[model samples]
Target: MNFLIRTNWWKWLTMFLLTYTVVGGLLFTVPRLPILNETIRNLHFHVPMWFGMIILFAFSVFHSVKYLSSKDLVQDLFSKELINVGVLFGILGIITGMIWANFTWGEPWSNDPKQNAAAVALLIYFAYMILRGSLSDDHQKARISAIYNIFAFAVLIPLLFILPRLTDSLHPGSGGNPGFNAYDLDSNLRLVFYPAVVGWTFLGSWIAGIMIRVSLYQFKKDSE
Candidate 1:
């Protein structure tokens, strides 16, 4: 028990679990006011999932940059793990957003710029994984994958944020502007929402780290 507790993986897992519990508990206890009511509840899950997805993708791109500059195999491994986790969060975010939209907007999906952009972003990442698999050699695979990851992120910026703002969306701040800025979110919502984002982002990273460690262990065992 002592040995397990001392491990870095265990420490991260413990922290992630504790944070999740605290955030979930607080969200549950908070009274739903008239202004936000049910939409506010969506914040406890939807917004956090998007934040987690962004964090994972950011790390994936960072490692891709590192791999290009340093040619490190470990960086390549980290990039792959980050993408795997990012994709999971991205899918969750989309599903949750779809549910939220159905309640708030009267439809499960609108051609809303945000929705379209999010779908495009997911497809781009999927293409990245496909590009990695197409390569036969390890070194070549790492190099090409890193390049594709960087490009995927570059494309993601516009798809997720920029393009969404250019067109009108049935979603918030759609018709003439982007939403969720300083003026859009009230103080009460920010209280629980911000912490939720942090907690979920940490949880996402924790999962990715565990996956990376497990992959390393398996690789070592196979090599031996």
Candidate 2:
């Protein structure tokens, strides 16, 4: 037990500090601000969680392309693992956003462009997974999954970011809603936000690594 704990100490420490920093930053910063009050605390978890989710999904798409180009099973495994982690983060983001919305907007969900766009993006990736499962042949599955991943990413760009900006939204930065621009965030917020993004991303990658290792082990055992 001691050896196991020692082996994983750094990851555990990093996660602990990440949690502490996020909570501390929110507690210190949000309460003192006039406009934000208690509601601003949500920013610490919600924004970074979504940002990490997007990053993981982007990595999954990249690995899917690599697998298609090289016909490497390892890349395919990595891609699938990344997709799993990305979905987890996506769910967390949705839950956090819903909580924030309920408190701030008096509703759990609104037909905001950003919200709808994010939902569509999630559905698109979910469809990619379904497409992969429908195929039986390994090579066919890899090829089809790769193509679908690429297509999903193409749609993701406009759905999550561009379309949200183009139309009116009940959420921030749309339809004259009060929102953060480049100038709106404080330096302190940036300090925590950047680390939160990096930490969550690394954590996702760590999870993907574990999944890939487990898959490899199972494959070896089955072959033996």
Candidate 3:
């Protein structure tokens, strides 16, 4: 009972935080700024997607490194599950951001540097999946995919974080551009925003856990 209860605590927390974020994020009071206006409310939902993606990708690569070191198929499975969820989040982030941009900037594809970088990152992972599919040997697939995933994450850091700042970007907080009041949320947006990140990230983990279990079951059934 204790083991079950302890292992599942974060699942409960994920549910609670997401409920709070959904209820409060939609109805909560937010700063009224020019250009952003009420769209700033997207900060809670959209931004968290990227945060969740980053967190999941980092988790993915960590397990990938473990797989490389130990050659454990379980670790490789975990890594794949993490990247699957991470890519889902990344796709959601890009779509939502594009919608937000379309409303605010009058075009869905503004060729914004940040958006381009995000697209590139997603493409690299898509290539990773393709590479994985091409291999017939499980061990060889795991070894090569793990190495590719590590490199993808390494490039992702700069593409997602550094490169945007180095160039002129329409995204908030790039160069002289202030991010919708420059993180000075005055505690209004942060309340929901922080929880949104936590909620979405844990939710991704929960989904990944389900995928991992299913994969393990299939692996076991195949072995038997």
Candidate 4:
């Protein structure tokens, strides 16, 4: 795990997979579903962003738990940078989702259960950043933010995955709506979709890794 996080080889893989994802997503043949039709092509980019975001956030929470147990500022830094990249992916996911909604749902912003839930989830993380900024003591900031990070992820999982399903959500796999599985009867979408998820997730991790190394360097310099 540490080698995968710290090494540079997979960064090349991230680039290759993402390049393939973009080319294939834009030009690949997709199902000719009713409202989804050509828009179903968005499945490659849109769904992958959420998958990446969720993965990043899960990693952040893992580091946050590690920080709490070890009382290690480095673990706290890992949690912070992970959340930073995770939030970026979440924002991109929302933008892409809104674009898809405009094309398929006829509006950029509807009161869809999942949409609202996603927004709320982002706001919770936004508050996490705010909480970190509001503190001056490094240890205090790390300790509080680490706890908040764990709780934010707890809320995020239910908000994005569970609550939307319990209500009438327009999003696939939620409410009464059929997911990509139902539409992707031929397995064509999975080819690019799965790669897209891994590529985006790796890309986010790469960015977070860079930030972690930079922050650790600065921390060491300050301590010295």
TM-score ranking, best first? 4, 3, 2, 1
- In the range 1-224, model 1's lDDT, one tens digit per residue, is 11321357755654765476455634554545444455756766776777788888888888888889999877888889989999999899899889878877778898877888888888988998898889988779999999888887888887787777776666655655445662256666566666667667777777887788877787678668
Instruction: State the lDDT at 194 in candidate 2.
Output: 65
lDDT of 1 at 108: 83
In candidate 4, list every pair of residues with a backbone clash.
none
Candidate 2: residue 188 lDDT (0-100): 67
lDDT per model, in order?
Answer: 0.75, 0.74, 0.86, 0.85
Clashes of 3: 0
Off by over 4 Å in 4: 176-178
Q: Which scores higher on TM-score, 1 or 3?
A: 3
Candidate 2 residues lying further than 4 Å off, grouped into runs, are 1-13, 31-36, 175-183
Q: Alpha carbon lDDT of residue 48, candidate 2?
A: 72
Alpha carbon deviation, residue 206, candidate 3 (Å): 0.6
- Which pairs in model 3 have colliding backbones? none
> Total clashing residue pairs per candidate?
0, 0, 0, 0
Candidate 4's residue-wise lDDT over 36-85, tens digit each? 78988888888878888888888888888888898989888888888888
lDDT per residue for candidate 2 within 79-192, as digits (tens), equals 777888888888888889898889878898988777887788788878888988899987788888888887888888877877787786656546543355522567766666
